[model samples]
Target: MKSILLSVIIIIIISSSCVNKNNSVQDKEEIIAVLNQQQKDWSNNDLESFMDGYWKSDSLYFYSGKKLKSGWENTLNSYLKNYPDKSYSGTLKFTIAKISAITPDSYFVMGEYNLTREVGNATGTFMIIFKRIDGEWKIIADSSC
Candidate 1:
């Protein structure tokens, strides 16, 4: 009985270690790719495509400058309201200053965002939380600072 219990403990530890390692590597690559795609889609001024990088469920949430926006539709509507035209959309440019994995399947990303438009250049900093869900990386929760 003691030997069986010991074996189970060893197995559990090894399994957890492997899971953490795999999740760490995958989370890093997935988050970077998702962020990169966001910039690409924004630069193209494709709102629909840009939103694809985000978690599309009803639970998806975002906060900007103290304003909390919940759900995918709300976020999309806000974007459309703000950037109605291509000129307003401008070209999305981002510099990822830092990205840290907070857990095996979660990350905290901080970056600077800029838009070059006919009117002027608008810039801001953003901090977003990304989570891996069902083997895909999604922005489960986000807040722009």
Candidate 2:
């Protein structure tokens, strides 16, 4: 009886570990999809749709260059001010460098962004913290350089 119980416990632990690993892969894929969608939206000049990947909360944070922006509205305002039209927004592209699980509910992602615009071309690197909230993966914090 004791050996049977021990074997069952070990099996349960292994199964749980496997499940967690699978969940991490699924979460990473979902987050990447969100990033891809953002790029598509930006290329289409749909600012509102691009912002959908971000956390829609007052506590959301974004840092670009030397500027620190707080809240979803502020971030949206900054994007609108910086890219007022398609000529400024341009065609966006992303190259993911890394995506790692920070926690079961959070992930850290680093990527490079390029914008082909009529005004000029722009390229930057960004690191983002994505958190699973309300059953959705949303970017909680972002830093672009």
Compare the candidates by TM-score and give the number of the best one.
2
* lDDT computed for candidate 1: 0.85
Candidate 1 residue-wise lDDT, 55-107, digit = tens: 99889889987898899888988888888877888888878888888876778
Candidate 2 segments whose C-alpha is farther than 4 A from its true place: none
True-vs-predicted CA distance for residue 23, candidate 1, Å: 4.6
Clashes of each: 0, 0
lDDT of 2 by residue, 46-140 (tens): 99999999999999999997988999999999999999999999999999999999989999999999999999999999999999999999999
Judge candidate 1 at residue 143 and give its lDDT.
80
TM-score of 1: 0.80
Stretches of model 1 off by over 4 angstroms after superposition: 1-23
RMSD of each: 3.4, 1.1
